[model samples]
Target: MITLFRSFFQSKLGIGITLAFLGLIALAFASSDVANTGTFGGVAGGETVAEVGGTSIDTAELRSTVETAYNNERSQNPDLTMTQFIEEGGLERVLDVLIQGAALVEYGEKHGIVISKRLIDSEIASDSNFAGLDGNFSEAAYASALRQIGLSDSMYRARLRQSLVANQLLAPAFIGSAFSENMAVRYAGALRETRKGKVVSLPSALFAPDKDPTKKQLDEFYASNRDRFTIPERRVIRYVEFDASSLKDIPAPTAAEIRARYERDADQYRASESRSLTQLIAPTEQGAKAILAKVRNGQSLAAAAEGTGLSPSDLETERADYAEASNAAVAKAAFEAARGKTVGPLRSPLGWHIVTVDAINSTPARSLADVRDEIVATLAEEKKREAVNQFAEDVEDGFASGSTLAEVASELGAEVKRTGPALSDGRIYNTPDSVPEILNPVLSTVAVMEEDSDPILAEVVPGEKFLIFDVAEFTSAAPPPIADVKEQVTAAWRLERGSVAAKAAADKIMKAVRGGKDLDAALRSLEKKLPPIEMVDIPRSALTANSERVPPPIALMFVMAKDTIKKLAAPLNVGWFVVQLDDIVPADTKRDDPEVATFRTNLGRGAGQEYAEQIDNAIEAEIGVTRNENAIRAVIEQLSGSGR
Candidate 1:
């Protein structure tokens, strides 16, 4: 639950909680009102879904949290539907999280654990999502993110405060958990245990009925499992594209304007000279004179400064600029010296200076005519950029004043193009490659918008190209008609029925094996042609090797007692499996082994998680939790009906 909350609320802000503190604190606050029953479709008192102490979680709050979680999940999996999410227990999970959060906050306050506003402010200020280009927190970015996620300031702050208080309450329990050495040794021994078994496969295809499903049966199956056949929502976008190239009437830079710009930057065109030098600044005049005398005696300045644990520094600057930065006397002496010549042990604000001139560079003064072409190009580019920006602003203002996208495009003398229907993932339906590159960026943006939403101006290529777009058509995610997907529905119905038959076959085989018959003999007894039985010997450690998932039959075999048989269902309606455990080899791990020490540390972390869960339950029970079952059910149904 903590992971879920953090992933949803802290996604944009990049807030994180380290594992050393409260990462193991998984709170699952199952409500005590499971038996509380009411009408299935009516709103209850004040529409409250749950109550923790004096705090009431109303339906609106519950709905918002559920929506946020659902949206966050959808960002990763576009095919997820509200019905599928609810059926997988998302609604109950979110409600449990909310109830637990409220309980923790209220319990903390009762125990004198206070969360200050300034602390919450610091958390917000440190979040990178709200930071500006300069890396400081920006109010505008913060507000915009809040609007995008549909969270208000107070709501976000309350969540942050609750998080802080919960961490304070659970820290001790999480940090203090430990596993003894003896316990660690026992766990390591278990990991080294091995099992031997015999297994048989019952493929679903062999059990499937020969006849095809009827229309009536297929319809019922499709209706019951609409989520399996439902398509994701898609939209058709209509947009107008414009860029700096679209404006053909920008005035060229005038000759007078070019001359004026040159005058404005007169220093750039003025005659100037700069020298590159290697100078060593010494703290004492005596040391400076010594280094200068060495250089004048044919020693390089760098070599002379080696005795002082320093070296000459290289610099290139105009004479006047260097004079203003250092001493005028130092600059004059350095500049007057010929290339490859050494100069003065002079004094400046920094210290005594020993200078060596490396090279001289001079720039001749230029008239206005010499820089005319350069100035004209610079001015032309600037004007074009400004005009493009102003034009986009005008279009935005026009939108704010209620102008339609067509009107804006027509007035701007640009063409408005419409795209075929496309999904939120940017794939055009029935024509994958037909979507223009210009519309690619806005496809996902416009996918969620209402048809009546104002045209959005998107800078596709920064200042170079932009698009103003709106949704032309919207098709909400839903199951296609039974007629349109009969073949798929029929295939699904057959697979489901076949899975049931396969489970029965697996059960019969297991019963026969448990009844003292050999595994091969039991397979021979079955009159139907069945898959051959296979023998296996596997070490427990091998099941977890390389972090790969253990195959179902092998995993089930390891958990069974010796000489026992169990039936296991395969995933994805593929088949069923039966395993008979034949032998068990007990592990004999030495106490001094390195793996034992590692096991102790890992097992202690698991124990810490158990401790955290206990604390969560105790806090909730002390605070007193009650939930409105009918209200929660109604909210779930409403959200499912909305097809979010």
Candidate 2:
């Protein structure tokens, strides 16, 4: 069975991933010979994915790694099945991952990096995922887990050691240098303060006909800044997008077809002896007996489940197939004893348990006749999906040959919707007040396109239907004649005049206030907020939008000498604001301020992240990633071959 996996791994995706896995566990595990792996379990000696110099990684081990991942996934998703997991490229994906790990481990050894055994133990000990109810790594729990996967500590440790060594080889490049202290202070200050300023805004709609600018002025502005108005170069394109939803029903699996499948794969529908069990445990042997007595005397399960202490009953419950004895400790004892039987006072690690079998629900495998309809429906949906994909492609092809969006939509029964010519800055498409964030990025792509292009595939919500757009025409942007924007130009001119006026007004008020003129009296003629003198702490990311804010300029006024007096400037966005920075807060060394400390720490981490990114770029460049994107479509096409 392990040998059957060879052809897939022989490919780069497979071999590369497999090598990574070997590289992870190669050091102490000694990949001497590849072991045979099967869906049922692992056995020694099988075909190898690769040999790290003299070391070999077994096919069985590769399968086991996949099984571990499967089990881990199922732990989160109770609805997932092993069979479904296998079919969704889950098994192949797992093998590739393991191989990559092996390769990394091999790479480390070839480079002379070493991972100590103590480090491997520390990793296991620190893994909260593997901890017991006591929040500690229980040896018994660990052993039980390994037993289910047919791995000994020695085997598991070997892999862990190799993984660490490989990581060690890579970590230095990722953390090339320590962060500077100067960066930390700057970062901390930026995060700890917010700039406060008053603003005056110019509404484009406010420009009136009387104030409209001349065509000469408008043309001069347009001519001088042509690049701002120029649209990006775009290509007209046509492409067929293939996705699971693009197709419709799978192949037509008729009654006979369904029957044949069900007959051939009846074992797939078999039901196992799964049990839902509850347990009551106590500390000492005598305490176990006492707890069993209490449970027998009708103590509540909740009371039995209280925290670790004397007279406390530790309650444990798990759901698992009866044969998987490790998933439920006490249930195994009860199942062995008999249905409706009160078993021990069983002697297990945490304490003793009073176990009872509430009910025995035995199930048998489904006969082919029972699930035939289901099999047919499943096969049909798959074929339908494939057909849908084919139809979409046909529609795209027709449009590419000079058909319109309406024509394509009419043929494929796809809906047609239109949005504005959104810009690439993501502003017009996705304003804070209008349009969706998802739509912005897609619309931005559409914004610059000049082509009678392919239907744009817009990302909808995750794992949901996508939106496709076909461009019919593009309205290339050209500067409108000033006559066309007469009203707008007039309004803009008024605001420009108001801005200059406001600065003069603010200057007079500020000087009078500073010269001991009544502060409230000085504000009489201005439309500014009165002195509540409020303050706020906001990060640098929140403060700056484009350029200089009033906070710094205002702060400068406080310590300004006689020669440097100038009128206060008003902000461009809102009502009149006067800024005054009262104090300069230094970075406090208080340990209680985790926010400050964490900001500093993140700056350090940012340096490492930058280095890691650089190394990733170098590796990718070295590897020369060639994407035959057409091949991807070919593979998907082959899988969705049955266009029902």
Candidate 3:
């Protein structure tokens, strides 16, 4: 699947360039802009990675950007390593983005594009990382976040200015651009082309070593493919939780306060009568009488109103309130009506009211003593909530004042607990181990947090429950000792050996078929009985029509030259395939074909991206990008800890 997408991205469309632009912009916005001046092991801080015109990108800057990108990727892919990240073009992509950004900035300056300080300030203020509890920008939070990342305010602003400049320069090129009709038609025609092929599979198991590998051989295999056996970084989380019940000594509501609360809402305790009415107001008295007559004749008030293109609504209101809203006469009629009875076509400012008394509720007035107990309970709850909030704030302040998790836990009389090592995605590192459900919310929080840094207080159930936690033990990602995974390593070794033999066999089969022997005859010529050759007929459009993964053998046949046979290795050391392309059929498509219009529309959407790429390329060419290969390599090595 990865190969299929890679092939498409690398094709004539060059979709990867557009994707690179988008991904880089997202990374630029998300990445911490702190320029770390710290040395990376043996690599000097000032070493140049690349120079765009007269601007130099130092090793420190590159390391920080690559590290941020690696960390971002690692959060989603917990097992990802710096080495794997670099291998998968992480280094090149980040370096290319850096170079492009520098080029854009330099070119923008020459062309009078200016990114204002106000814009950069707005960007910084809008970042959620610097937001406070009130959900607004906080200067203290911004400063604290910068301090944690070792990025000074000035450095962050400068880096932000560059990104803003680049966006200003490229955004215009991304609009109002499109591919030509001829180019669109040609692309559409290519999609309609078809190919016929034959594929023979040579299974690795057929050539695998029957005997077990020696201990030395197993060790060597484990050493070479250590990444396969390595585990993702995991941490033991330590935390203490507390809620409202934990805050003791909350003052009970006093008699005076309860009395005051009762007096404040004295009107609620007064005698009153309210009617629940479903009514419809008509345009005239005759219409109201017609509706009332229908209600009397077995139809519901709502049903009767429906005939007049109107609907009856239900509302419960006190007599005085209803009178004020309508008129005294209408209210008197509704209030006088018995429960489940329909009342008159009474006149009001809102035409005439045909009302149904759905229900009539009566209340008797009460003295202050009657609701005093209820008021006390309400006031007590309010006091407890306020105390709980203050307690939480005090705990946070304690941590902010250099207090440890254990110290805060001791003060609160809460037990500090340690969880089994867990991954960023909240899975137990040891499959058999488990932690209490209460700790789940904090696993992701502590995953990216530095070990032994300040503990954080997180709410588990909003205002009701909370947790204060920190990383107690941190383990870096690396392969375990060979002895622990000997059996698994031995199996892998056998598969690797088998795959090599299978590839050799596939080569022979390819040669036989290319030299005029039939595919089945060639397969029969091999010593081992292989899987039978399967013939495939596929349309080029079919490869991408449903967005499904095309089998590697079929995918390989599509890209192969007609009348040629080639050996292609299957993924995961599964087997080897001998693919023979029998014929290629050019698409017989007209200029007015529906597919042509479809492709034109699709390609037109990406025209702006092509324009942006061209603009970027032109800018780089004009500005002259000079890379220091040795320095770049050193920076990657330092980030991967290989230099150490």
Candidate achieving the largest lDDT: 3
Off by over 4 Å in 3: 1-35, 38-60, 116-164, 241-402, 412-415, 432-468, 527-529, 604-608, 624-631, 642-644
Over the stretch 1-644, how does candidate 3's per-residue lDDT look in tens digits? Answer: 01112232342224533323222332232333435566758898788989999899888778766766666666567666778888888778777877886787799899887766755666677677666554556565565555434567886676677766765666554332445668877897788889998888888888899999987888778878998888778788888988867777888999889888778768767888888999877657887898889899999986675424345679888786677667788888888889998887888745678888998889999887887766676666567656655765787688788778888888878999987788766778879766788876555456556576677766576446878888888887778898888888888888899999999888888788778898788788777877667988899889887878988888888888889998888888978888889999988778777666556655654665677778888989999999999998887777677410
Compared with the true structure, all predictions reach lDDT values of 0.71, 0.46, 0.73
TM-score of each: 0.64, 0.37, 0.64
lDDT, model 3, position 81: 73
For model 2 the local lDDT of residue 126 reads 62
- Per-residue CA lDDT of model 1 for 1-644, tens digit only, reads 23454443332111322221111121121111221234323544257889899998877666655655665465567677778778887777777767777888899999998767766776677777666444556565565445334456875677678877767766445332457888889989888898988888888877878899876887788889987888788778888988757766889998788888889879778998989988777767887888788888888987776424345679887786577546689999988989998887888855777888899999999988887877776677567655665776787798888888889888768899988787766678757455788886655456447676777776676446878888888888878888888887777787788889989877777778778777777777656688777888888899888778888899889889998998888876778888889999989898889787678766765665566667778999999999888888888888788645
Q: What is the full ranking by TM-score, best candidate first?
A: 3, 1, 2
Cα TM-score of candidate 1: 0.64
TM-score comparison, 1 vs 2, better candidate: 1
Q: How far is candidate 1 from the true structure (C-alpha RMSD, Å)?
A: 16.1
Which structure is stronger by TM-score: 2 or 3?
A: 3
Clash count list over all predictions: 0, 58, 0
Model 1: weakest 10-residue lDDT segment is 23-32
Best by TM-score: 3
RMSD of 2: 18.7
